[model samples]
Target chain A: MKTKNMISIWFFVGCLLALYGALILAAGLQTYSNRRSANIAMQNLHLQGWWGTGLLVIGLFYVIRFRPRRLR
Target chain B: MTSIFSAMLARTWAPTSLIAAASRVMSLGGIDLTIITLYFFLVLGLGLYLKKFTSTGEDFFMAGREMTAWIAGLSFISANLGSLEMMGYAAATYQYGILVGHAYWIGAIPAILFLALVMLPFYYICQTHSVPGYLQLRYGEATRSLSAISFAIMTILMSGINMYAMAVIMKVILGWNIHFSIWVSSLTVAFYVMAGGLLSAIFNEVLQFMLIWLGALVIPVAGLIETGGWAGMVRRISENFPGQDFTHMWRTLGSFTGNPMGVHWTGIVFGWGLAISFGYWTTDFLVVQRVMAAKDLRSAEMGTIIGGLFKMLVPLIVILPGLLALAVLPFKLVPETMANVPGVHTYNEALPLMLARYCGPGLLGLGVTALIAGFMSGMAGNVSAFATVWTYDIYKPLIRKQASDQHYLSMGRWCSLLGVVVSIGTAYLVMNFSSIIVYAQVVFVFFIVPMFGTVVLGMMWKRTTPAAGFWGLLAGILASFVLWLCVKLDPSALRLVAFSSHAKDMAENVYRAWWSLLANVVVTIVVTLFTKPKPEEELKGLVYGLTTLPSLGQLPIFKRPIFWAGAVAIAFVLLNVLFW
Candidate 1:
């Protein structure tokens, strides 16, 4: 009998990071539009948007690459 | 109540205070809470999904020995990378300057390499389910029982301490209810571990490792940017504290009074670099079990080498942030005792303080989730290890010798639940009587050194008798306890153990471990000479001279364990010299 492959841990990690990235990116866009100053240092760099985009890209790559496939 | 528990933890670990800053508590925003909630859902989902694969006893206890090198390697380090170590070492860096980096480098790397290149083959060949199982094979049931019982008690108590510490941190940092944090986290861990066992634990540990890096990485990056770079940070620290060598790792080690930690170079080398480091990395089943789950002998060795590499980088997230806090944070951090005053922060608050300084809403949530992941993963590691040892070493052998594989699997699940419950009980016990934490530390110190001595002797020397292993371990424990009591009764007597009047509690610990290990080795040698040795035939496959080590000649140098270990060693030396 052919054994089924278990879901990769990276898939879960990817999904979580992707979801978090999108949420953070939306929040960042809202903050940017409102032109409100956050209490954190280096806020003007728009780190939220940058970091969120980075996470989204990496997360999406991991999700796609490690996604479970049926064994033949 | 939270402050009291924090104070107790501060006292137990010493110098690295866990007290909250006197400033207002930080609360999570909606986005942040959502990220944290999603983590809970994901872990539970993973556990439920993995249940079908965990039907057999081997699957439940060992992940069916099917884990790849990467999975096993990441989980191995993650199991040790708990919130306590992260927070404590960061705080240590803040207090003692860069000298604390020695713990991550010299204190860990060589021993980890030893485990990968030398010790792991024996464990892999033996097919032992746990460290105690290996002991039973090398010695006898008596030795196994002693090690397993002590380990079980220690693990559960440690899990409880981790639980309580996390709850207190949550209460102090986020103003959450302590009971709510404890119960929610404990029940979640227990449920998932019961469902999927070691596989579930390993999966979550790998995820936690990633979360920890991403969440905590922001602080060091932002700090470096703000303070220029490594050179600028060093200059700032020197300017802040005049006439002090806080940036150099080895320059201040010539004399005990030369460094903030009051430890000499000898203590760092023989005591920590040899005894304590070898004791933990080689023998601790919690981390070793992860490697034991690897798919092959090469996978196990490669996994350990992988762990050693990541361990070398952990200083970036943990130690560098503490250094950054000293150079960049606007407010000065006092000791835990002085943290009660307004605007005063404890050294332990370095990590969280850096988090608040650099992280805004969504990022703040991610950082907090990373800490929570660390705490839960630590608790899960302890509970899972405890369950396995209890079922295999204690229940199966001592209580019921004859049982079906399904029966043992059922017992393993029940023990996992029971371990969590006991850990919760230990948490409350600590809440009432905080001194138990200090006692637990002393007891742990007693075990590790002696156990390492016994195991190493048993494996390398075929003439070692079972009686020698048992008695030698007992002698080491008693000798360590006596030394501790002497220091307790007469503080000046610490010189006997640590070799100097200026040596602090940390130095005393390492020296004490070295002495205990020496006592164990000497007594084992003496006892072996008097007692009848195990027959050479019986020692086959277990003893070094009698066993045939596998040939690695066919594998390429890049794939060999020795080659990677050499790479790790070179990196280790470069790091030491660069910091020196």
Candidate 2:
């Protein structure tokens, strides 16, 4: 019974991360280029996008796999 | 003329650097603001939603022990990966070079494994809610009370330091009133923690962990790309520092004489690795509480192991940028930001400036949010731990021992709110002492060094008496204070402790930990021999010999905790070799 509460919490956190990830991912993809800035930092929007995807995938995995298995 | 890096990197932003960073974050557009605002409100909403579940003290403090390994592990490390750790350590790397990696590598990995393999079994089997509870069982009430008081004071001070540091950083970045930033951050953390207790804090820490990695990981990627990848950065670093040992981790570690860290492998291996790391990772309540909250022994142990694994990779984000800043940030940042101190430069601005320099509009907002998340997560970790220790160890035992669980739950919420208020007061105190804060900060290392000695002896040996534990702990703390005082009086006094001539604050800290631990162990041993030990029945499941140790005989070899520990330790040794 207590497991159900934690599963819900995990699901909630997973969904939030995925949604946030998707937002940043869209912008990152939109800014896709070799160097996103000329400020000597040379930040690649592409790599930034990859992290977004990583968070998204991990979040999705948690929500999917940790979904509570109802008692038989 | 001093280097250009000194000119460009102001020693610290009085009001201007804050404006600059605020402008950088502000320029990221309204979409960024909206996202940050929504994120804040969502966290608040989660806290409110979880309030329904925290009906008992157990639910409030431990989340009813329902946390999976992943949740516990991420929360475990996230609590320690506060934004200051990012900014502070980045600045440390900027100033000290690659040697700081020892703090994460040898300093954390082994101790974490030790906790998982040896300590977690005892903690879980005995059902101790907090580190102090372990003391009560293993030693007695006197030792437990003493530790609980010291740990209580220590945790709150740390939480305040987090609040003060973040407030100062944000104030420097956004030009916000320091008091205003303190109140706002403290209230936000206090609110969420009060509403949902540890469950809310853990959930947010997991969220914050993901956000921090997402935002922070960009600095290295961007820096590497611009610097022409790994070889380019290294080549440029060599060119920048010329003959100075900027990237060597172990080559110069053979001697404490002329090294940049001013200490040899003895300091790293004994001071940091065994004493400091073991004391902190094995016994410190802040991280240990997270481990204890896991659903079961396996989850708790695995959570610590997972944290160790993640700990191994932390340097790339935290340290690499400081190394990159050496070559890429140009020489002008130094002279531009040079403070009143002659020949000194402000490197504390490394992480924030890195964020400002690289991350574009959308990504910049994410970065700002990540910084905010880092500070908030740190604040929450402290407050919840404070609340738990206060309610369980201090208030419940001393003030009202027989209170109903429901009564204790309310007190837990009340304590969370009160802890933030205390942190705010302490934060103000810190602001006043910003210049010589290093002296005050010695409290953190001192508390742990002595506590570690007593805890290590108590857990492993059955002969350690209650009187011995109490006296040893008290003596260790006082001894640490005296050592630090001598070092502070005459920086030259460090030589008496065998510290190198070129020793800096970090070196002093390393040696101080070592001497204190040895002193603590000596005191404990002598006292234990003179006093009567607890009988066998009381020591059951508390000491190694008396306890029926958990075995993984039925599990497959790969599924065993030892398998993971071996994997992490092997990787640890290989990394040392690779860097060596």
Candidate 1, residue B47: CA error in Å? Answer: 0.8
Instruction: Give the Å error, residue B42, model 1.
Output: 0.4
Candidate 2 residue B89 C-alpha distance from true site, Å: 0.8
* Residue B464 displacement in candidate 1 (angstroms): 1.2
Error of 2 at B395 (Å): 1.4
**Which tens-of-lDDT digit does each residue in B1-580 have in candidate 1?**
1111111134425321344444544778898898899989998898898888899989999999998899999999888888877887787788888877877789889989999988888998889999899999999999999999998998888788778877877777787878899999999999889999999999999999989998999888888988899999999998888888888888899998999878898888887788878878888888899999999989999999999999999999999999998898877777776756776777777888889888888888889988988888888888889889999999999999999999999999999999999999988988777677777767765677688889999999999999999999888888888898899899999877888888766778778878988999999999999999988888887889899987766887898888999999999999999999
What's the C-alpha lDDT at position B564 in model 2?
Answer: 90
Give stretches of model 1 more than 4 Å off: A1-3, B1-21
Question: Which candidate number would show the highest lDDT if scored against the true structure?
Answer: 1
Clashes of 1: 0
DockQ of 2: 0.36
In order, the Cα lDDT scores of the candidates are 0.84, 0.77
Binned by DockQ into CAPRI classes (incorrect, acceptable, medium, high), candidate 1 is medium
